[model samples]
Target chain A: MKKRGIGIGSIFYGTGYGNGFPDVSKAVAQLKSDGKIAIYVGATEVGQGAKTALSQIAAEVLGLSVDDIVFINEDTSITPDSGTAAASRQTYNTGNAIKLACEKLKRDILEVAKDYLGLNSIVGLTLKNGYVYPKTLPEKRVSLGEISESLESSLKEEAVFTAQTTEMDEETGQGAPYWPYTFSACGVEVEVDTETGRVEIIRAVLAQDVGRAINPELIEGQIDGGFAMGAGYALYEDLKIEKGKIKNNSFTNYLIPTSLDMPDIEKVIIEDPESTAPYGAKGIGEPVMIPVAPAILNAIYDAVGVRMTEIPVTPEKLLKAIKEKEMTYNEGKN
Target chain B: MKKIKLTVNKKEYMLEIKEDTRLIDLLRDVLGFTGVKEGCGEGECGACTVIMDGDIVNSCLVLAFQADGKEIITIEGVESEEEIHPIQQAFLDVGAVQCGFCTPGMILSAKALLDKNPSPTREEIRAAISGNLCRCTGYNKIVDAIERAALYLKRGK
Candidate 1:
């Protein structure tokens, strides 16, 4: 017998090392003499598209396309510290550092533009298409290359972004910790086979609040990947341990979602901007996966009216639970 | 060690392999074809997938001696000098690559499917590449990439 049910799960996650930990990131933006911009930050890209997102942020501030910015190769010796990539902090912490640095760098470039264009004030001057010009008169313009040549040296600006948070009380464990918290809500439809204890996800939709979407495509990809991991964690992965030794250590027995196993995924982006965040964009990496397991578990309970407490809900365990429930129901009938 | 003759990426190589060497070792260690990734030594992950005689096989499970007179195609052979394969281009255009650990295998599996059936439905594409696993980008974008690759291939023809 097969049964189906739909369930929803919602959660909130705080980005960075929360609980009163210091969260800080620094970035250096350079206006190179070659009329291009270079940004140096120690933010490692672990396939979450951190580099791309950061590059987009820097480019937006300078009114240039993504290609105009030269993203310096991240090296500890050459770049400022943007903190670790964990806790979904790269997009917010490093993004803010890059954004603040670029703002300062923009001001530095405008000073040269004001003098080069012989303008009384930089109030009406703006940088666009590799040139600085007045909004009213596009003809009275000076190229960035000319400004760089006039300076005879590159202009550098660095900025540090730190989050303000307070630790919890010693006994009550209550405090407003972690900054720029992200939230998400997920709905999943699943089918549970009573005889075999197989839970197949039919469809999954995640509505996430990304604070702001620096890159919508990358955020969608992250949501899909995170949901797949959550589904696997809820139904398939079985890491057995005995006497301090890990059994099923390899991927052979521990299964992950394959192309056929993944269900239809629909991403819904809910951008409720954070005032303090860079470009009002927050990290969606950790929060996307937080609500998936609970949703799947709830869907399983909804389908067969059985309360499942543990993870994976493997076939054997599900079948046993089903049988016990049936026995209890028959006894009550008698 | 026995000498075995095989054609890889349109190039012929006559190599000597130990009896205990796996096909992956022959390709990666001996021939320096490191594109075939081995996520698991067992045949489950399909990370070491390659085309052998027009069929996709996990190189990790095949013995080197068994591939004596076979023709194999690894990820290194998928691109030409002028441009990458249409499938590779489609993967990029569709945002199907992330971390790229499983990309080589996924591309090869998709290649094998397209070669056999130029026009595949979404279900068929899923069934064909079910053996390969990708943790990033999920499978949606990869499937979309393959569908787009099919279109590109037809237009080029």
Candidate 2:
């Protein structure tokens, strides 16, 4: 692992689409020829499963299973220039790139299938378990190995596809729609300790409008993970920043949500598949985090009569607020 | 450096290490169990949590020597060969993993709770993992996964 692998340099291509990019196909072919493998582009799985999503995209497009895909995403030299894993764009953007490559491979295979099977159009060909079959003739199938051999015999169609997306404006922060967005709504119920200023999440319902449920189980996992992160942001987690340096860099000062802190979460995956996505799937990376803080805040307000607007709503803060409310009530009586 | 032996996930390891080395480091760097990660490297975040003698303790705070001669269980030791441990499987099935960085620790925390009390109320499960901070999915699904796993474990499956 390179020391700079997780640095800011790996995140932005430029400002938007063509920012930190590489000659994708050339890199892939060259890497393969050199016995180098395609590392799944992005940061390590650190809990977001960027690698899994990337593999799903490649497999769906290449007409292969996720097991066949091996990624070496940690290295800088061998992989495509995948920006950061933040904001959930790995699947949204990188998946599309792999999907595009897969589509190309599929088209080329269909042409071979068309010529060999005496068919004119490749429109109705569907990929099933690495085999191509026409809807009318589901029983008739051509193995991917056969197509691979045919392609290898004819042309070296071994290349990777690269994509570029634009960013927000430098000054105005307004630009063409930045990459597609993933959306979700978090509904939460909390119980506040009237005495201790502790906020307990009793129950939570996360309704995510993911462009597609590429992997339903994984999608839920993303939401669950986000919920914990968000809950921490709301009730417990705080990075105490003084100037720009973190004062509470250690865990002792910065409080995070524990299992005792969370409520029962019912993850609702609303799949509104995006055609722009590899398989109608949009990235759920940041969206899961986006709504969590607000949801927990709302729940806290609902739980307690006092509407505490600030974060980490520590017991001390809550106690002060309660006292202030009492003082205000006494003054009103006078 | 004093030599110490510890049983981790049913396996024994002997090491000669400094006093300041954290159990989290010992597990990941020394033991080659990268599944246990350091999110906060402090006790506030349960990302370094592991089961020690059937209770959940943040591996970050436990000194390497303190963990010495104790029976410890990391995420890698949670499951048998044929199937995922109940907590792990429930996490997957319930969508409890997103980035999966905090997963091993969170699962281990849940395991600790279930081991002590096989049938935990929802509140108990939440209290169990409150130390773990996940930045991706919210704690809703994680709690759900724990509840589901508790049921399965209680059923003896």
Give the CAPRI rating of model 2: medium
Provide chain B's TM-score, model 1. 0.98
What range of 10 consecutive residues in model 1 chain A has the weakest lDDT sum?
Answer: A248-257
- Judged by DockQ, which candidate is best? 1
lDDT of 2 by residue, A1-334 (tens): 1000000000111112333333232112111322122333533466667677767776666556777656657577656565656556666666666665556656766777777677768889877676778889977777666665555343223334444455556788666435454556777666666677666666677788777777777776666666777767776777878888999876567765555555556778888787666688767765776677776666655555566779877778877886688789899999
In the predicted model 1, the residue pairs found to clash are: none
lDDT of 1 by residue, A1-334 (tens): 9999988999999888888898999999998777889999999987889989999999999999889999974689999888998999988998999999999988988888988888888887889878998898899998777888898668999999998788989899899888878899999999999999889999999999999999998998899899988988888888889999998887778888888888868999999999999899999888988899999989988998888899888888888988899999999999
Show model 2 residue runs off by greater than 4 Å: A1-46, A62-65, A68-74, A115-126, A133-141, A150-183, A192-197, A296-309, B1-53, B56-87, B131-133, B151-157
Task: Give the 10-residue window scoring lowest on summed lDDT in candidate 2 chain A.
Answer: A1-10
Which TM-score value belongs to model 2?
0.75
Listed per model in order, the count of residue pairs whose N, CA or C atoms clash below 3 Å is 0, 45
Alpha-carbon RMSD, each predicted model: 1.6, 8.1
Native contacts retained by candidate 1: 0.72
